[model samples]
Target: MKRKYSPYTLPPWLRKVRGACAQFIIPICVFQGIRTILFPFTLDVLLLTLLILLAVALHLNVI
Candidate 1:
């Protein structure tokens, strides 16, 4: 016999909020990368490299 698994499902509201949070975080990082690239004097090169790595990891779903 097969058993149904119900615990994996999330309510609509929770799903919406999670999606919103992801949307918010991704753009901010992207903007930071762009800003860093445009104005390299203000922030350290290592910080910019880390931000770019973060963006790549996000795209690759490593984070």
Candidate 2:
């Protein structure tokens, strides 16, 4: 069976890094989204989709 995930088991420094990433993810996603809207390039769209998925995963604490 797969083990349950626990942030508490992570190293202190890693936890801090995760916290920092969680804080910045939203604004980054927003900028990527606006950029995608303006450019609509294949790469930009793919990046935006990845960013959105990452943001959702972070918000849901699934990462």
> Which is the leading candidate under lDDT?
2
lDDT of 1 by residue, 19-63 (tens): 565566667777777777888765556666666676665455444
How does each model score on lDDT? 0.63, 0.89
Candidate 2, residue 61: Cα displacement in angstroms equals: 1.3
TM-score of each: 0.39, 0.92
lDDT of 2 at 54: 87
RMSD in angstroms between candidate 2 and the native structure over all alpha carbons: 0.8
Lowest-lDDT window of 10 residues in candidate 1? 54-63
Q: How high a TM-score does candidate 1 get? A: 0.39
lDDT of 2 by residue, 1-63 (tens): 999888889999998988898899899989998998888999999998998898888778888
Top-scoring candidate (TM-score): 2
Clashing pairs in 2: none
Candidate 2 yields a Cα-based lDDT of: 0.89
